[model samples]
Target: MSASGLPMRLRVPSDARFRPILLTMARRVAESVGFSAADAAAVGQELAARTDAVTRKAPLAETTPIDVTFDVANTNGAVFRVRARCGGSDLEVTRPLPLA
Candidate 1:
């Protein structure tokens, strides 16, 4: 669980092949917030796209451990945020722009 107790986390080796697992995790998180199955899946794909892009370019990623954290918020209605972290770097995706 995450700080808000409504999060799911996956820790895996920093390898491209494991990206799918992370994406699956994201999809489930999105659906938890009421996204339709297809929309939730799209969110997962987007999360994977951004995460893969970041991890591929991260320094020493091939050897670093990565942690993907998924969270859903209900404060102002449903919102989702996912973070893929390696060492001190963070790659994050969130629904509903903070300023929107």
Candidate 2:
């Protein structure tokens, strides 16, 4: 939820790829909020620990494509914005060569 009280959503085709991008952005945001890299990592580590428990379960078989969106707010507590969705089949994948 944002400062104004709106739900944030974010989607990814798979949790594996989504985590890195999210973590990077979060680290940056934490730094902006006066957190050092070590601090950010510590926070991130805790979050990852919790998330790991949830994601360890199987993926949603029905949805190979994932969509994620978020309601983001600035540090000033004003100007709430929604970030673009960042997931789904948009990720590039190389086709395997056929066996001879």
Of the candidates shown, which would achieve the greatest TM-score relative to the real structure?
A: 1
lDDT of 1 by residue, 1-100 (tens): 3436477788877777777787787777677666778877888898778766766565555657778887766667656778778767788777851222
Model 2 Cα displacement at 14 (Å)? 3.8
Show model 1 residue runs off by greater than 4 Å: 1-5, 59-63, 74-77, 96-100
Can you tell me which runs of candidate 2 are displaced by over 4 Å? 1-10, 61-100
TM-score of every candidate: 0.74, 0.45
lDDT of 2 at 5: 36
Query: What would the per-residue lDDT of candidate 2 be over residues 9-49, giving only the tens digit for each residue?
Result: 55544356566655565444444444567865554554444
Q: Worst lDDT window (10 residues) for model 1? A: 91-100
Residue 100 in candidate 2, Cα distance off native in Å: 65
CA lDDT of each prediction against the hidden true structure: 0.72, 0.42
- Which candidate number maximizes lDDT? 1
